[model samples]
Target: MPMEDAGAAKVGPDDLQAMRPHSKPNMPSPFGRLLDRATYWDLMIVASATLLVSSTYFWLAPQSQGALFEGRALTFPEAVYLSIVTFTSLGYGDVLPVGFGRVVAVLDVACGLLLTAVLIGKVASERQASLLLLLHTSDTQRRISAFAKELANIRGALSEKSESEATTKSNRAELYSLRTLTQSISNYMSFNGFQAGIVEFGNFSALSALYDELDLAFEVCSRIVHGSGKNSDAVVMARAVSCCTRIYVLVRLMSRLHRSAATRSSLFGTVLISLRLKKPASLTLAEAAAKNKSELLFQSMAIGLGKAEAWKARGYHSLQLERVLAEMPSGSKDGWGNQVHKLIAAKLGISNSVASKCVATLVELGRLPK
Candidate 1:
């Protein structure tokens, strides 16, 4: 086994101990955790409870006798009104607290200030989150649009009968750039906690357009391979394979996210049912459901055309791009043709007979070697 693999496999107590400090540094304090978990409704409930408790003390305490409403003893309703006024720092002056009631009033004012601060902080954070999300969405959409246009230009270049060396070099460079961009976008979508946000914000249309562009890129790759004839440049072929494989991984990642989100929604719905609560309709869920049918169809078609099963047979998992490239046959057109056949078969997940037929069709269409 490789040294890294061996180290990963033999994770002993020492390794865990070494990792502990790294994990503890960012741990939230109890109060911080409470604030993070608290919702607006939770804040409202806490405020209501505080008011009720304070009002009860003012109404029942002997020290509060003849303190409120110009020396008149407070009733429960009058006490509640005083609590609200005090909590808001209104100081209407109609009600006055004397003796021990004065101390309670001071503490109540402090609590009011604290709660107000927390409420302001919460609102500010939410607005900040919304602004960040908007910026991210806009940036992502812009990138995707540029990527699609570049892919289209490359596809156009690939279609021309007369290809200059300079043009070929340019196309290769563009393909490499596109592959890098695809990987970056995939990482962003997968790791940045934005998948739900993407769905919620109705960016499925953008994603759908991206998928379409990737499909065009795949077609462009087939053409490149076909035009290379018997003496294809290994570097160019490798680049093409890298591009296609990355696109495949991206599609699978999306499909997996879609399925996982659906599962989460279903589980959450079940919990709501058991708790006798109405399940709130989620924009993410609604948008996902609306887009699911067409997305699945596109995925199925793309997989069928690409031969997804052949990729699985070759041990090409979503994160194993290096392995896929390492295993690719180098410096031989016949070898690359067979690889392409497998690529199509693996991506589409077709039966062996279907795969063979697809290969034969490609061969007849001059898209692959016989």
Candidate 2:
């Protein structure tokens, strides 16, 4: 219909119909959340367990009188297969579930219908939003962004599997270790040193949980090197330790470099030892001459920290890095570890501007991420 035609109804772009907001259905139970938080593998195992339990429930459902199909005698796998086919509405007509299981099958079909309707509606809205999004972006970047999003999803899925694999075999500590490093950095950048340490330390305690998490992790590592059966036997743990050693040395060295004389003395020992084990490489000017304890500490941390910069000259995102580092215990004035951040930040290739802002924020109590 032409809008300009006499007596014709007109609809403007703003007056066009709009889709409803997406509804996130199928929220997990509290128990599911508890499992998810504990370990991804825990989630998988629990779900597998639930499938087994539910199969039994479905199996126990009473048979109906004068029924056409009796899937009650089917095996676990067959029942599950039939359940999937029914729920998806594929109904191939090969086999059917009968009796109370038939009731279960009907309920599943209803759930599937509700889910499909919601998903289709949501997809329509998302396509509209995506069109709006693309209006502002070039074709190339949009494609690139979509590709990246897909890649990220794949990586996330793989990471989940890896996390679960770690949990099942007693190598789960590395999950916490990676979590600690990630949390330590993220918490500090988004929160503060004492706050970050406390949060991550709590996570450590929850998993390693010997009343004192940090102390326990340190003890476990010490014991493993010194021959303790209780220590992590899974090689997955070695990666976290190796990563931690590098990060610890990096942070320790930075703290000493950026702290006062007294602080340097405290952190120097930790920095040197980490470097000796990790063998982080040094950089220009930093390697020239580490005259004092602080300088020496900077030299050590700079090695591991420097390698990261070398790899990602501009990709490291130093604005967040300095904020995270500054929020760490090692980055604080009262931090007991030998500290070295100023030159370390510079060596890690953070700009003078970013370094200043991070330090400024650290010395203050404002501008935490939401």
| lDDT: worst 10-residue window of model 1 | 4-13
Task: Write candidate 1's Cα lDDT for 291-314 as tens digits.
Answer: 574366446545543543233233
The reply for model 2, stretches above 4 Å from the true place, is 1-56, 63-72, 130-370
Best by lDDT: 1
All candidates' lDDT scores?
0.58, 0.38
After superposition of all CA atoms, the RMSD between model 1 and the true structure is: 12.1
Ten-residue stretch with the least lDDT total in model 2: 1-10
- List TM-score per model, in order: 0.46, 0.21
Q: Per-residue error at 17 for model 2, in Å?
A: 30
